[model samples]
Target: MYKLGFIGMGNMASAIQEGFINSGYIKADEICGFDLSEIATEKAKARGVTPLSDGHEVIRNAEIIFMAVKPQVVEKVVAPLKEDLKGKALVSMVLGYDFAKYETMLDPSTRHLTFMPNTPIAVGEGMILLEDQQTLTDDEYDFIKKAFESAGSVEVLPSHLMGVGGALSGCAPAYIYMVIEALADGAVAQGLPRASAYKLASQTVLGSGKMQLASGLHPGILKDNVTSPAGSTIKGVKALEDGGLRAAFINAIEKSMGK
Candidate 1:
C-alpha cells in the first residue's frame, strides 16, 4: 500500500515500474512519475500511472521516492527537495552516485536506500544491489526488500562497495550484449541463417551461464569439460584465444572504471 514516486521516467525507472505492476506488488495509481518532456509524461500516463508536472510534486505525494534521474542532474534535483523529503524512503538508481551523496542532499529525517538494478529487471531476471544509510529502520528495510523483489533478486552489500557493484552490474549489460552479438555473428559467418544463428547462440550462452552458476565450476574448467581433442569446441576455443577475447573483456572492465 506504499505510494511510490519516480522523479525520472527514463528507461530504468520505466523498467522498474513495469516490474512492479506486472508482479502485482503495486497498482499504477500507487506509482507516479515526473519527467520534463511532454512525450515522457504522456508515456508514463499510457502505463496507467500519473505523470507529475514537477519533481517536487512527486515528492509531496509519495511515501517512497525513486531518484532515477541521471547522475549529472542528481545534485540539482535533490538540492531543492531537502526540506520536502522528510518521512520518505529515498531510493536511487543513479550510477556514480552513492548513499552518502544522497544523504547529504535530502532531509536528515528521511530513510535512504542506494540501489543499482540492471536492465534485466525489466524482464524479471534483474540483479539488484541495495545499500542503506544510518536512518533505515527494520520495517523500512523490509519494505525496500519487498519492493525490489517484485522486480528481481535483491542483495544487500556494504555501502563502500555500492559504486563498484553498480559499475560491474548496471553498466555491464552493454558488454554482455556485445559478446552475445559477436557470438551470433561468428555463427552466421559459418553459413547459418542470421535468425537461426542468434537463436542458437543466445540459448547456448544462457544454458552455459546457468551451468556455471549451478555447478559452481570455474569458467575455464567448464570450457575444458566441453572441449575434446580434435573437436569443434577446441577449434572455437583456439579462435577465441587467438583473437584475445579474454584480454579484451578484461580491458573492457578496466576501461569502464577508468583504470
Candidate 2:
C-alpha cells in the first residue's frame, strides 16, 4: 500500500504532497491521489504523485488517507464510500468540520484527525493546528505529528480550541499579507521603489516573526523594544494603535469563529 492517499489533489493537497516529499518523510512514489481536475492531476504528477483513477482507488491502495475536499462536498463525496472507510485513518483538512461531526459520518472503528493548515504549507513554513483526538494510536499520532513538523510548526489543541487556533494561525496569514502590502504601499508613497518597498516590508515581517519565535519573547515586549521614546517607530505604532489595528484583529478573529 502507498504511504499516503489524497482524495482531492487541489492546491492544499499538492502542498501537503510537496511537504512530504521535501521533508523526505514520504516518497513521491509512495503517495497516490485522485482529482477530477486535469490541471490538478498534472500538478500533482509534476511533484511525483501517482494519479489514481478514483478516490476509492486511492483509499484502497494507501495506508493513511487524507481528505482535503471542500466542506460543502464532504458529505457528497464520502457517503458512497463510507463503508469502505471503516477502520481507516482519515486526516481531514476540510474547514468547519470537527471530530464530533466526523464520528457521526464515519464508522465507529475509523480513526479521524482534523487539521487546519494554511496556504504557507506550500513554502514549508505553515502553522498547522491539529485537534487532539484519542481515536488514533500512539504510533499513528506520532507519524502524523512528525510528518507535519517536518514541514512546519505543529500545535496540538483540544477540539474546542481548534476554531480559535485555526483563526489565529490559518486565517491570519491573509491579514499579514495585507499588512505587508500596506506597509509597502506606505513606503511607495514616501518615494521608495515599489519592488524595494515590497522586499523590505516582507523581509521585515519575516525577520520579526523569526525573532519572536527564536527569543520566545512576548510580541508586546518586542514591540516595546523597537518603539523608543519620541522615535519614528513609536509614531508609527501610535498611528496603528489609533487606527484600531489591535481591535480590528480581535474582531476579525471573533467573526471568523462565529462569536
Candidate 3:
C-alpha cells in the first residue's frame, strides 16, 4: 500500500483523509499526519491516522506528502525540511503558491504539484483543480490523479489557469451556499417552514446542476426551457436580473481573485 502523510491536520486534510478512507482507496494504517496543535493531532488520531512528532517525521515516513498548511506559514514550515523532502512527491494545497516557489525553496528534483479542492470533498463530491511542474513521471502523476479521484471529479489544467479555475470552482461553493440560503429565505417569506424551505431550495439547485452536466446543454438554453413567456419562472428571473444577480456573481469571482 502507498503511504500518505499530511503535514497539517486541518479541515481540508481531514476531508481528504475521510474521502480516501470512505472510498476504500487508502487504508487508515497507511496514513500519518502531524500538526502543531495537539487538538488537531488528536482529531487526526481519532480518525485512525498516526500522529507524528513533526513535519519531518511525516515526510520521512510517507512517500507522498501533503502540504496542507496556510500559504503564509508554508515557507516557514517547509524551509527547514528541505533536506527531508528530497525524492518525495509533494502535493500542496496552499492557495496562490506555485511550483516555482517550491522548486526555489526545496530540491529542484522534488516532484511537486499544486491542487485546489473545495469543502465538498468531505462528501466525495468535490471539484478538484490540478497543475504540475513537469517534474513527475507518468506513473507518479497517474498515482496522484487516481488518489484524488476518490474524493471527487478532478481536472488537470495549465498552471496559469489554476487561479481562474480556483476562483470559479473553489470559491463558488460559498457563493452557491449563499444562493441556497437566499432562495430558502424567499420560501420562508412565503410562509413555508424554514427546514422545508432549505430542503426544497437545496434540492432544486442540486437537481438543476446535475441536469446541466448530464444534458451537456448551454445553461442559457436550459434556463429558456424552464422560463415561459408569461409565467412565474420568467418573472422570478426578471427580478433576479433586475437585482443584478449575474453581475454580482461575476464581481464575486473577480474580487475573489483580487481583481
> What's the count of clashing pairs in each model shown?
0, 0, 0
Residue 59 displacement (Å), model 3: 0.7
Residue by residue across 1-259, what tens digits does model 1's lDDT show?
A: 3288889988888888888887788889899879887877787799898987787888888888888998888898888887788877787888877777766677778888778898888766678998745466778678768977987888788888876777777878888888879988887988989999888877887798789978999998998998999999999889989999889877877777778
Q: What is the lDDT for 227 in model 3?
A: 97
TM-score of candidate 3 to 2 decimals: 0.95
Between candidates 1 and 2, the TM-score winner: 2
lDDT tens readout by residue for model 2, 1-259: 8989999989878888888788888889999999999999999998888999998898899988999999899999989879889988899999888899898899898888999888777678889999986477778889988999988899889999988999898889989999999999999999999999999999999999999999999999999999899999999999999999999999999998878
CA lDDT, every model vs. true structure: 0.82, 0.90, 0.88
Q: CA shift at 191, candidate 2, in angstroms?
A: 2.2
Model 1 pairs whose backbones collide: none
Instruction: Sort every candidate by lDDT, greatest first.
Output: 2, 3, 1
Off by over 4 Å in 1: 132-134
- Candidate 3 displacement at residue 68 in angstroms: 0.5
